[model samples]
Target chain A: MPINSKIVRRIGDLARIDLSITDVDMFSEQLGEIVDLMNQLDGVDTSSVQEMDSEIGNGHENRPKDIVNEGNCIELILKNAPETKEGFFTVKKVIE
Target chain B: MSDLASLTISKARDLLSTGEVSALELTEHYLQRIESSRNLNTFCFTATELALEKAKSCDRLMSSTDRGKLCGIPLAVKDIFCTQSLPTQAASKILEGFVPPYESTVTERLWKENAVLLGKLNMDEFAMGSSNETSVYGPAINPWQDPNEATPLSPGGSSGGSAAAVAADLCLAALGTDTGGSIRQPAAFNGVVGIKPTYGRCSRWGIIAFASSLDQAGPITKTVRDSAILLEIISGHDKKDSTSVRCEVPNFEAALNGDIRGKKIGIPKEYRIDDTPAEIIKLWEIGINQLSDSGAEIVDVSLPHTKYSLPTYYVLAPAEASSNLARYDGVKYGYRATLKDDEGINELYKRTRSEGFGDEVKRRIMVGTYVLSAGFYEAYYQKALKVRSLIKRDFREVFSKGVSAILTPTTPSPAFPLGSKNKKSPVEMYLNDIFTVPANLAGLPAVSIPTGITEKGLPLGLQIIGPAWEEANVLNIAHRLEKDSNFRIKPKQWWTS
Candidate 1:
């Protein structure tokens, strides 16, 4: 499906990127090209090829030993910040 | 002391161990060189006093007989990896002022080995660019001299800082993360040696995740032996990183000395894409010649699904990154946007993220979110995952057919100009990773070794890829190539100029 302005606006807003009108038009064209390229995959015969997540084994199913508190010193980690408040970084107010 | 900057970590350690040179003196020499070469921009933050202190501490350890392989050796940690005392911004504004309370596992390992911390090197924001120009700080200039190429050249990203630092002698060697070709591409551009070990070999506890599935921290150094020694110190299992394998880590130092007399090396047919430069093709041929001369048999192999690598990588890496970066919302940790009287949580998040992430990073997150969205998952992400398996299967089949390793170019082209993409579309730049992304998708080990230079004087790299946990083979061959090749090149005087 071609990316219309509505989809472009949704993606731009969701991504929080400030895209100019020029970028929107360019990106629309690019997205169309990408979708067209992806459509080529439709021709491949995957009747015998079983879908797999990883080339390696599916290690995600088997959980490893639980050891949650492996993080390092909190004080040293926050030492070189430009701004922080109560262990959290502070930035310019993003919304009204 | 003039040649002090050019000495490899192996040579530096030998000299430092014998008390022929003090660690403080060595650190001062590089610090002075860095101060003079402001054009290189190799370092994002040069912690001179901290480096001296670390060197002094290593000196004490050396005097007390607790010296390890890297004792008193100064090395830079790529800014993407957290360092306890230095800024760990990962070259992005969102991470500004964010320093980790603890060092990354890899950085800690380097410290444990008594490798003196030089400082944090610059990189593309979140390890994203092919050229180092995407860095928040500025592009790191290629230290190679080329009168024809008067403009500053990019030391390839996202590990451009580490590669440039090593190339310019700011540090004997440095650590860099490879998600796609970050380490290898920069290593090639800077005319150095870099290795991205097989996935799961190195722990990724604190390296900022660009794409978790593809990210592996590796060493960028002047020679393959130095890379091996550094890898020996850094590659191992860390419980904090669950993806790290618990298998016994081989002694890469010892493996480097192994005989390659009867090794079967495969040259991948697919890596030679259309419009591949004649120089890069020549570099690959020279690499084949070198390996054949070293008593290794060469065979032509094919990775049939190679063309699908860039698209698959774009999907998978962004999908993983989108999930990984979700933690950076305004509330729990870094980059919280101050809420106004009327703004809701959603608005705050949108504002915070908008202000925090760079353009490329945001684009990736959007791409990732789109592909992984519930409705599109089956069509985009799942199919990409399936194609990923076919790509990996191609490698497994060829490797099982008795090919020990695959040879390819780390990039289709050498280092582009620092601002080459100012006018080029983003996809044009993304296509540069086409050659290097396949190994990442397959989770195999690969190395970039400086083979030769273009007539323009930019260094070219020969990529050696191996099966899972075959870093030993990769490093051995790269070492042999470096030993035999007449490429005794160094950074331009701009490094000292």
Candidate 2:
């Protein structure tokens, strides 16, 4: 495997996600095939190719100030939060 | 009236304007069609009452001088967009009930033109899968069939429901966001018109983020004209999305004169894949001859880096997706797991995310995190970025040859049996977007139009890709091709009694 189970676990931790034992096994196999697919990029000579940092949308990076900057949905945004109190999101306490 | 939903957006526009049909009546008609088409599962949420009410108001407003081309036209919205009253879940459990109080900039623009929202359509979970099978509500079935066999076929994803709805006549048109062919692929599968406008042509403000750099909102409709008109209404400079271009919004519909007298159409040599079915190859030949017959010069082009696009996209998209989707932790919003008495914050994040995201989403996020990790970043992610630039340059080079558009088969095959892809490995399914991904990777405009039917008795689509910010050109060529193909095959009403 280009990537192993331990590495997959490490990735899960970084992504703030959990993988079931079955998913871990399945992903290990699936991602191995996918990684092998990624290795195909090694065959291409991209030495002179400049890495794409931005994107093709609106080739111009410079823009005037934002025309609409209203983020006034504090209440509406909080409506879907799992736990909320006084307009702030709540989570399990970590520090002792 | 049962088939009133089958009317094209342009025709419906004319009908409503002439008072031949009230917007209320039109909305009611589609709402009933939507109810009967439940077996297709095209809609994730139907805004029946709201649609009727909006149609009533639109009817009343028609008494005055204020109106637009889309006034009183009923359209379906992909669940990915955040509509005020409609819960935009993106067909994933994580956002099961995550309704935004505000509307997406694109959908907001729709209402500005008096277009009625019929409901939110279904899609892949977080727009991750090629087959709609990844959706939490189960796969949205392709309405196309072989007439005799009862085997359910898939409407391609991640905009599966949007394509299915448009194909099945559940809505005149729908809003579908494309990242790596989500919009175009499904449109091809369902034999509908779907355009993925040049990146940043339409604002990405309220549409849920997938691969942020690659995701762009466009329209899926029944005809080239409808897609063009919807694209016009939904596209513009939005201060909310800084990436939106300052380029003047052209009269997209008016630009559809179908005059391609001297335009050069590119046929990429690399797109002739070894595994492509002979039927699809024949369709491509037919499309080429038709375009040439319309007085357009046909030129063979080469996109050497085409083979690398899918690999590079898989790497970069998931990497960006991992970063973009990081916001779904338990604290901020979306689905969260119930914390046990002994649970801690770490458990909160993991349990919530594990419970929230589906298998495909989780796989991508893990792969994304893996590629971006310290050691692999140089070997994988950075390399993929360089390769991405090569892929983009390939399109630039071809366009520089004075090629206004490149013609290719939308899907290697027509729509497949719904669960057929499930039996294969994820890599096999990822191969489904082989042709459609290049345009997205280049951030160029592309459209899928129904070309003909396969021997399997299913409809197939052909794709035309254009240079960045050249959607008008792409649509014009598509409009020309639509007339040439004269494809009028509709799916047999097998699902309805």
Candidate 3:
């Protein structure tokens, strides 16, 4: 499947990255080539194979009980924030 | 003091135990070397005061019987690992000025063993690129130079700085993360030893996420024994990381008895790709002979799904990266673009991400998002997952056949000159990870030991990969090969005045 500039633009938007016209043109070509590379997978018949979700054998069974093990360091959590107000992360207003 | 920089962790430990050299003295020597070799661009940030303070503490603890394994060893880390209060930008502009509040489990363990932090090393932005060219700090130039070529070579990445620092003797060893061939490939290119332990061997807590399932942390060092020591210290179960297995942390260094007698070593026939450079093939043949000479039976095995590994990796890694990177939405931390008066939150997100991420990172995000889109998810993501199963099964089958480990070339070619990679085609660069990616897909223990040099005096490495959680087996074989190869060549200190 050939990836067109239109599709590349949509992917950029889905990823929340603003792409320029030049970026769309370039990614269309580069991603097309990469898709061609990925197309090689179609040759192998994986009809009987199960999806490998993770390399490790164990699942979330190893997770500790659902409890708040860590907290109370509001200052540390907010230290790297771009904007903060009164112990809360401040972002651009979402509601009018 | 200058010569002290060349000492390995093992040697320095002996000297420190005897009070022949103080920890502060050793740390000062490495600090001086790091200062002098700034032209290599290996370090993005230097924690000079922190290192001196840690060294002083180690010196004070010299009288105590409860000293840790890596006490007073001055080491740097790939900027991907979060270090509290220190800049932990994963060498990307998106994470500029982002100091992590917590240290990564691996680094925390290292500090528990009293390892001193030299600073944070440069790497490919988000650990995305094969060459260090994608780094926000610019390319960390390879200390190894081709005499005939005027262009500087790549140290290979995303652990480029870790390998370069170890190669240049700027530090004893450095921590590096391997997502695809990040650690081993760079170590091969820089004539150093690096081992990516089993996927869950080290906890991923506090490390910047790239591909959640694929990333594993390891050490880049001057010797195989040094890597073994560091791996033992860093490997253990972490409840913080559910994927971190509840396995025994063996004394990896003690397992290096150099006895591979009667061990069955498999040579996967499919790795002999047609485009592989002749030097790499020659070195691989040499490696096979060395292992066989040590009484290990060399047998030919097949991994038919080997060709599919790289494509599967490209699809799946990006899919996970797209999801993992969504946290950087210009709200909480890192770089946030200045917004216009009328710009909405969505616009802020798009602008910040667009302005912050590099070309390669954006390319990956685009690819990942497209693959996981509703229309293409089944075709790309699901298919890649099934192929991943086959790849894992291939390794499992080979291991079940009494084959203790698999030996292959760590890379198809030695380090190429910086900026020589074709910008138009990204797949060409992705090919560098071909030989090393299969092990990661299987979550196996693999080590790259510097075994030979190319005709141009550049280093080449032979890899030994063992079954999952068998890091000791992998390191033992690597130690045998390291001793037999006697690869002691180091790049000249051209950057020093």
TM-score of each: 0.93, 0.97, 0.99
Writing each residue's lDDT as its tens digit, candidate 3 over B51-168 gives 9999999999987888898888899999999999999999988888898889999999999999999999999999999899999999998999999899999999999999999999
**Model 2: per-residue Cα lDDT over B192-287, one tens digit each:** 999999988899998899998899999999999999899998998888888887678899999999999999999999999999999999999999
Candidate 2 clashing pairs, residues 3+ apart or interchain:
A67-B239, B153-B418
- Which candidate leads the pack in TM-score? 3
Q: Which residue segments of model 3 deviate by more than 4 Å?
A: A56-63
Q: For chain B alone, what TM-score does every candidate structure achieve against the true structure?
A: 0.97, 0.98, 0.99
Q: Which portions of model 2 show Cα errors greater than 4 Å? A: A56-58, A64-73, B1-3, B422-424
- Superposed on all Cα atoms, the candidates' RMSDs to the truth, in angstroms, are 3.0, 1.7, 1.2
Residue B140, model 1: lDDT of 83
As for candidate 2, its interface RMSD to one decimal place is: 1.5
The docking category that best describes candidate 1 is acceptable
Per-prediction DockQ: 0.31, 0.73, 0.74
Q: What is the C-alpha lDDT of each candidate?
A: 0.80, 0.88, 0.92
User: After superposing candidate 1, which stretches have Cα over 4 Å from the reference?
Assistant: A13-23, A33-43, A58-63, A70-96, B336-340, B422-424, B495-497
